[model samples]
Each structure stands twice: as structure tokens, then as C-alpha cells.
Target: MVSMRSALRTAPALAALLLVLTGCGDSGPAAYGTDDRTITVDHGEKFTLKVPANPELGQNWYLASPRADAGVLKYRGDREDTGDGDGTQFFDFTALSRGKATVKLLFCPYGRCHSADEVASKPVPTATGTPKDSDQEAAYYLYTITVR
Candidate 1:
């Protein structure tokens, strides 16, 4: 019941489709999360940082360090908030040059963080000073990135 002619015609079409689906040998940028030890990216490549957040409850994540400067990473866009209830915040960035940069983020309740500089200046809350269960202050997450 097999037809050699039909198989041959579909083979070339399937091969072309496969190439498109596989991106035609294009490898995109890499991504990393808070748990990653240290992130490394290439200049002109994009990267993302995702952190847990609950905007509905007035808790959100804020970028806290490295004000935009030449020869360093730059914020590509605003955080993309996703999910319901406790969700995640996606921060996108692009490596501008070959250098090292530290990214600090803070998770603060509503009215806590008005600016990145304000958030960066404050000390990371301590269990003793702001008991973990306390409904005051904010928490921090830091990541170091090297661009090549």
C-alpha cells in the first residue's frame, strides 16, 4: 500500500519544516534565575531574571543597583508580571559591553520602595531587626553577571 512517489515528495517538505522549527541553526541568548550561582552573558545578548512576587497583595520586586552607565548592562524593559496569587516578575536586560555588573533586587510591600536608589541605600532586613514574620520592611535578592 506504500507509494515511493508520495514519500519522496513529503520528505523534502518535512525537511524544510524541520529546519524552520529548529530555528535554522540559530542559538538564542541564555537565561538565569535567582538560584543560579553566577550568570555570564555575551555582549548584545539578552537575559532575564525571574523572581517571585505578589502584586495583588501590594508586594513587588524592584531593581536596586547599577544605574544605567556606558560599558555595562542596561534594563531592556519593564518587569513582566505573570501568574495569579503569588506570581513571578520577569526583568529583562541586555549586555552592553564586556564587563561585570551586579544586579540587586528588592521585594517590598506597597509604599516601601519609591525608587531604586532608596531601596539600594537601605540595609537588607535582618531577622533580629525586622523579624521574618513581621509585616514591615523588605527582602533582597542579588545576582552578579559577567559579560564577555
Candidate 2:
């Protein structure tokens, strides 16, 4: 009877502790995928630009080089997660210095993008270039970032 009383008294505390622990993990960098036009971060900070992709339907993404200032930011790489059926592609980057840079994300649907080499061959987009929305056939998203 004494042991049962102790367990019952501590059960709620244990449950709360477990809940806090479960939420602790590498949640990755802050995402700037929404309506924010400018992303600001501290020097040496990391951030991710996540976009939807479904390669089964020929939906893909590619990072456009020369669009971003390498002196300000470093392009870490790209990745994909299709486990949830709704595919997602992410571009990881780290702020290198205190300056402004623009990251160009290209969306290619229906296999319009032949290969990475082809995308690489495309000329760099001018700073004033307009980025098309993803719903269109080929869309370009320009993200301006400032690191302090």
C-alpha cells in the first residue's frame, strides 16, 4: 500500500519530465520558407530553405549558383525527404560573413531540368530578375539574406 502511494504521487512528475525530454532533439536550423522576403541571421549561423518536391511527378529543385555571394554565405548542400509521400527538398546554408547575399532556388517540373550540369550552364540571374512562383512550369525563387 505504501509503495503504490509513492508511485502514484510521482507519476505526474515523471510524465512531465518525459514530455520535455521527447521534445529535445536536433530540430535543425530555422526555416525561412514562408512569406518572409528577407532572412536575417547572425554570423556563422545556419538556416534552411525548404520547398516542396515530388520527383515521381518530375518535381525537383536545384540551387542556382552565382546568384548568392559566396563571401557572405556558404551553400552547404541540398537534400530530399519523400517518406511522407509529399516530397520536400531543402537547401542548407551557413552565414559566413556580415553582408547580404541572395540565394536562387529553381523549381523544375515535368523533368524540364535535364541535369545539374544543365542548370549550372544557365547564366546567372541578374539581381533585378523576377522570380516566378513554384506553381508555374519553371519557377525561380530569390531569397535575400543578411548576416550580422
Query: Candidate 2, residue 17: CA error in Å?
Result: 11
lDDT of each: 0.70, 0.76
* Predicted candidate 1 versus true structure: per-residue lDDT over 19-75, tens digit per residue: 999898776546565566379888998888876666776667777665544468888
Off by over 4 Å in 2: 1-26, 116-134
- Tens digits of per-residue lDDT, candidate 2, 71-99, equal 99889888899866778888899999999
Candidates in order, TM-scores: namely 0.69, 0.70
| Ten contiguous residues minimizing lDDT sum, candidate 2 | 124-133
Superposed by TM-score, candidate 2 places the C-alpha of residue 94 at a distance from the truth, in angstroms, of 0.6
lDDT of candidate 2 at residue 112, scale 0 to 100: 79
Listed per candidate, the RMSD to the true structure in angstroms reads 4.9, 4.3
Tell me how candidate 1 scores on lDDT.
0.70
